[model samples]
Target: MISLVSLLVAAALVCLQSGYQAYAQIEGKNDLRDNLQPNIIPMPKKRALRPFINIAGPPPESARLIPGTLLELSCEVIGFPAPTAQWLKNGEPLTEFDDVNEIMNIHPTSLARLTSKMIVSSAANGDVYTCVATSGVKQQMASTTVVTVAGNDEESLFGLEALFRKPSKPIITEYYNEVFQEIGTSILLPCKHFSTSPSQVYWFDGDEKPVFGNPRMRILPTGDLLIPSLHWDDMGNYSCTVKNAYGKDTVETFLYPNKKQFFLVTVN
Candidate 1:
């Protein structure tokens, strides 16, 4: 009877061991199959970017005008994703101005441009207006075009018709005395001297008023004047004075507006 019990226990142990071996073999085959199988994740396709603005040619509405004489000052731009346009009156937002218009043109290829125009019936506010283009991607990614009205004493003339008189103070010059820019362009009036000592620089407009406080103009760290946008009245006399412990030296320059003056320069 004891031998019969012992034989039954041995037989049961052998059967359990065989079942576990078979299960292990099956699981190992499954893991091998999983590792050998190819997993392919599709990569996303890249989009073609729109052609950027060259800004090398004349803008859409490239005209010169005197103050309160323009029917309208047009600011135009080109971009993709159909950009939304806005305006500014003397560095202020479009909401303050009543006489303004916005026009948008869309292409079938998903590109677009905006033409923003404004009119000033009175000269009480200012002659400088701006056409600002808000980026389709971001508001900060933007640009501006200046629309200047003629000053009270200035004449309203087309870019070609407008004649710039020669500078009152002729050449004892170190730099270019004449800087002619388009109606809605920008230019830098450079002011520097070979002095090693620390010096102070001052800028003055044609009216003998200080240029430091103007909102439309900025003086860079290098004592250079940056006129980001140009208008009709922006044409005039500008002076840069540098003073040191030794003495003071001043240079005067004439900034003018023209239609194709710069184009001729690039061509030559």
Candidate 2:
């Protein structure tokens, strides 16, 4: 009976050992499975940066300009992404298609500069000009300026009446006698003159008929003519006449398309 009891005790011990070994193997396998699985971590989302304006040109003050002169308005900006610029006149956007003669120059950078230029005209007087900057972030900024055209009366009021008191023979101080431009491009026929009185200026085509009332052609208040878009029919001899009470002066110029050479170039 004693031998049988000892054998039963041994058997019980072996059963306990086997149960512990099985539990350890199962726990090791579970740990290995956990290690083999991927540990996923979520990524953070990106945010958009806002744009800012650093410098705006053509201050709020009235800009006094002589007719036929080039007027430039500029705006400078900085941002994470570059900004685009647009010009507005009298609350309306000015585009290349508009009768308004203007050109835009945009410089590339995170900090960018945009410049708008137009030949001054009598119609530009008393007009409000604005420049707007925009970015992809749905935010925009703007700046404004007022234009003032200097007339003979205004110049006289500033104690310069003697300048226009007596009529004098008109003298062409600055002119382009010949120019070669590309088709569909714009050109400026400069005919700046010097006279004692306010001169009456007119432009004539090759046929000698007065060139007026055309949307594409404009006589700037300063006696210069602007051709917004050049065409084949636009090539020919052009004459500019300035008259006053005392005398009159006449000058002629020629235009051609797709010609790279200039015969006579005069600048003032």
Candidate with the greatest lDDT versus the true structure: 2
Q: Worst lDDT window (10 residues) for model 1? A: 165-174
Clashing pairs for predicted structure model 2, backbone only = 67-222
User: Across residues 1-268, which tens digit of lDDT does each residue of candidate 2 receive?
Assistant: 1222253357567656665666666667767898574433223222322344433333344566444333444444332223444556777776531432222221121222222233322334577766555544444545445455546655524433333443456565334444445677666675656565667888987667788987779998867788887778887888989887788878776665543321211111
Summarize candidate 1's per-residue lDDT along 36-143 as a digit string, tens digits.
744332232334444343111113333344443323444444443334445555567756442232232322222333333444333332335555554444442222
Question: Residue 203: error of model 2 in Å?
Answer: 0.3
Query: Against the true structure, what is every candidate's RMSD?
Result: 27.7, 29.3
- RMSD (CA, angstroms), candidate 1: 27.7
- Give the runs in model 2 whose Cα sits over 4 Å from its true position: 1-167, 259-268
Highest TM-score against the true fold, candidate: 2
Which residue ranges in model 1 land beyond 4 Å of their true spot?
1-174, 260-268
What are the lDDT figures for the candidates, one per model?
A: 0.48, 0.52
